[model samples]
Target: MVYYAYFQGKAPDVTKKRFKTVWDIPKEELLAPGHRMCQGCGAAIVFRHLLKAVGKDVVIVQATGCVEVTTTVFPETAWRVPYIHVAFENAASVASGIAAAIKALKRKGVLPPDKKVKVVATAGDGGTFDIGMQALSGMLERGDDVMYVVYDNEAYMNTGIQRSSATPWGAWTTTTPVGKRWRGEWRWKKDIVGIALAHRVPYIATANPAYPLDLIEKFRRAFETEGPSLVHVLSPCPPGWRIPPDKTIEVAKLATLTGMWVNLEIVEGQPRVTVKVPKRKPVKVYLKMQGRFRHLRDEDIAFIQKVVDAEVERINKWVGEEAIGPVVEE
Candidate 1:
């Protein structure tokens, strides 16, 4: 899949040429450079990189959230392709409807028979894990030929940093503030990728913005999949995460290295570790870098570490082998 392409060395001629650059990624800007997104916004970078991979023959359906608010600021839009704005929880439904309509139009000869247009629905963690699950599930069950991408920043950052189901354990947010009553959000993060795999989507993968080639490759795969497909990206927010704006990519890289976030691909309900870590870094190396976890006591950090270790073990067991090496180039 394109999402896992960064891990692989072989590539098609086009991709090979693009990889000759310093970052081994394309330079074209489809999302434009002057958008209202915050400095070092991981989601914004994801959008830009995604468009560069797919080119101009795509339609985007965006749900109400940070990406929509910042990019489509009333009178202007940064998108160079066809873009549609939908309600917070209806992005999947809208994308499904658009995909179906395109088929109908082609059948009626209203459009060229050979024409191929891709439809992509995007949302944040709040929309995907909570408010939009019903609509998303419905679209997946119906086998809509649309790609769904969730730029998971782990909270409702647009709505004042409220804790969402995707928020990591022990992370601080407005509702999950650090105080005597609570050290941070105490619940486990929701597993949306696992839920999508259960729906039996043809393709599903997790990506990271730090690895641009892998991120764009996943976008290409999701668009090419025959049925509903999904790609979840670990988008880091500078202000919300209490990290330096320029450290977005660094933080994301640490997340995968520390085993806090695993990048995997699911095909026909089978999961493969795309970015394997032979010797995972300690979870504290990732945790202590962000202020959201600053309130965690030593025991709290230890508990988080144990959870990550168990997850890594589970993935290895599922694959029937230990990881051979790191997926991304160090």
Candidate 2:
């Protein structure tokens, strides 16, 4: 299907060879190193691979969050490509404006008619799930030719370990503290994929930095797909989650193995699991590694398991296959 609707005449070739492994990815680095991002930051890993997948012919619209602040101090920056730093609530809006300007420039013959520059908007959970919802919604509803990415670390890790709408149930944060009356955040994580699906955009997907190849492939799909696309990534935070720096990727993988996070892609409204798990580990196996859920009682863990079970079942039914099987006690 022709997805690039905003381009006049004809769109540039978006087709590219699929990545078979890490070695297949481009060697060029668009995001420079030596930034202020913490060690083992999942978002940092995400940006590295993401830039490699999309190549250098892209513009990044970054929201005011961890990635933006850390990567772009007053005098230095980690970005090598065209990058714009916007507010916490308007990354999508600014990206949409850029896309529109590109379309206009192509039509006016001011820029090369066949120039193919992809516009990508990136934000953390706080900017995406909470503050940027309105601007994001407008972008998707307008069917702007852009790809919006959310590197969700669950809470507002940049400002502080504050609870966001994306924070999971029974997880501790600065806002959702554990005490006599309150025990972490009591609400379940918001279904961001579902919300994007409602907009009927061309593409929607969930990715994890732990699965580098899968994450790269999904980014390719999002970049090639016509209209607006959203890729929600599960990013692990070491300081916020209270885990060691080296445990970032391990914890991210465990999230999928225990059904806490499902790796899937929805294209043109059809959903399918991109990375399948034949068998699942118990939820506690995933939770115990992080200090955020350490205060969770046995009953609390059981409740979380039930929630994961239901979500897994729902996704499997939608895909017409058991992508993630029932949890097995080991």
Best by TM-score: 2
lDDT (0-100) at residue 170 of candidate 1? 98
Off by over 4 Å in 2: 1-17
How high is the CA lDDT of each candidate model?
0.84, 0.89
Worst 10 residues of 1 by lDDT: 7-16
lDDT of 2 at 19: 87
lDDT tens digits by residue: candidate 1, 124-212? 99999999999999998788888899999999999989999999999999999998889899999998987886676778889998877
Q: How many Å off is the CA of 177 in candidate 2? A: 0.4
Candidate 2 C-alpha lDDT tens digits along 1-330: 354343212222334449887789899888898999999999998999889878888899999999999999978989989999979999999999999999999999988999989799999988989999999999988889889999999999998899999999999999999999999999999889988878877678899988999898888878876678899999999999999999999999999999899998876666788889988999999899999999999999999999889999999999999899977888
